[model samples]
Target: MADFIGPRLYACYNCRNRVALHDDIVSKHFVAGHRRRAFLFSHVMNLVVGPKMDRRFITGLYTVADVECSDCGEVLGWRYEKVHEESQKYKESKTVLEKFKIVKDNW
Candidate 1:
């Protein structure tokens, strides 16, 4: 018989609430505020997107909303609601979860 495995997940560091999936990771090489490491995820679940605000990043200006854990309300990262630069449009609707804020689950 063959063994079965489940989809790998990333959980909130504080409450252990499942937030993202390993397969959904778009890029591991990302940086958040204050030089903190981050990961770009193509999809995330159990998260609440906060208000949209304009912020300027190294790439360009974008409209983003803070994403929080739906269970515990912990701020995990931000989601790109709108991208101003055409070159950065691919990042729209994506979420960036801080590395330190998430822990591996179902590994």
Candidate 2:
């Protein structure tokens, strides 16, 4: 994970819409797409602008906010947000691994 440290560029694999996550975020980041309970709580995930969210399924295990590419409107991934669950407070965004790529030491 040391290789992940430094200036990183997070881009949507669909249209290559990119966002920068600096060293600080890199040092304390989480794998957004992991299925484990611990993986869903990471807060260092990058947020890209211009991408829109669709909550077609809002009443389920988790309130899903489907995210898309800002330019081409491709399916990037979904953000699992905690809704109506007072015991568990969780909100995390995940970009599809096949639909997104991270380039470390970008600068």
Candidate 3:
């Protein structure tokens, strides 16, 4: 017999709704507002992207939208809609999930 394993995922802390896959993470050393740790993911699922707005961060100014869990409407993080700095262009379309707002699943 063979052992079975599933894809590692990150779920919303409030609802356990799977939001992102471990494989989609671009960086795990990101810092969110209020000095909170966060993860940058290339793709995410089961999330509701809120209104787009310009927010200034340590890196630079960016147009972003808050991403909430579809199941419970909990604010998980934000998605980078537009990058104003050329050096930070790679972050466009990426999602940043707060570490405290997510729990690990299937791992």
Candidate 4:
């Protein structure tokens, strides 16, 4: 049901522990094609370590779903809400909603 294709609209860089903006999305978000910052830790090593690293440098970490605006490819930040809701809807469970409680409580 989900299309995991080439060149994602959103990428989670585990190396930096943050989501990164793609070029297309950056262009739409900034209107000048500035490189997106904030990368997750996983991506950092992938770029620097190459295949020799085996990608185990950053394990046991989870990332939120990618977000991309249809009107434009702007990376509108992480969509934890949307991702959680969709997972709940598809799984026919309220677990995601329940998890939001703690996140909301902290806020």
Candidate 5:
């Protein structure tokens, strides 16, 4: 069973697309790091728009830009990936869940 509590439930701000449930949010990283927002892991299937190259937040490490909703153009957190050739999965996206509205009602 999922907690679906205050910070556990999250949906897109523009469109109520459920990006992640209780299980998805990265443990201990809740609302930490760059911004004080819930840092969760979302797969490509969960997001409406994919990651595009933006300015580097951590220079030479990863670059990120707005990840918007397909239905409504609302900024929902950001999507980022490693730049340097470290590993095979370095190119894979590692998004930090933020800017989403918590699902108030039943999640």
Candidate 6:
């Protein structure tokens, strides 16, 4: 999968400090322990955003990605909502991307 939350903004997904994307040595430290836990938490949050049975408000907080503190095995941040006014008209669309486009372009 594409790293939408690119390493440019994410540091090892474990370290809060800044680091390069391809720095395998640094990332490996994070990946080896906390990667799975972080991803799983983020995955669940993503699912909540795309609920099949309910229509919900668009909150301003969103789970951009998961992060772990390299110094400690702590899962930080997940599935947050961002506040924005959106119409429910697109709720029936096939994909959330389609809804996002419509909402963004005000179509």
CA lDDT, every model vs. true structure: 0.97, 0.41, 0.97, 0.23, 0.53, 0.25
If scored against the real structure, what TM-score would every candidate get?
0.96, 0.44, 0.97, 0.19, 0.56, 0.18
Model 3: how far residue 47 lies from native, Å: 0.1
Expressed as tens digits, the lDDT of each residue in 4-104 for candidate 2 is: 54455555554556633443231232334443111222332444333244443223355555545455666444555444455433343432222234333
- What tens-digit string does per-residue lDDT give for candidate 3 at 2-103? 889999999999989999999999999999889999999999999999999999999999999999999999999999999999999999999999999999
Top candidate on TM-score is 3
How high is the lDDT of residue 78 in model 1?
A: 100
Off by over 4 Å in 5: 1-9, 27-35, 42-46, 58-60, 83-92, 99-105
Q: Write the per-residue lDDT of candidate 6 for residues 68-90, one digit (tens) a residue.
A: 33344344432223323354222
How big is the positional error of residue 29 in model 2, measured in Å on the Cα after superposition? 11
- Candidate 1 residues 3-99, lDDT tens each? 7989999999999999999999999998999999999999999999999999999999999999999999999999999999999888999999999
What TM-score number comes out for model 6?
0.18
lDDT of 2: 0.41
Clashes of 4: 15
| Model 1 ranges with Cα > 4 A deviation | 1-3
Determine which window of 10 residues in candidate 6 has minimal summed lDDT: 98-107
Displacement of residue 104 (Cα, Å) in model 2 is 6.0
Tell me which residue pairs clash in candidate 2.
none
lDDT of 2 at 101: 40
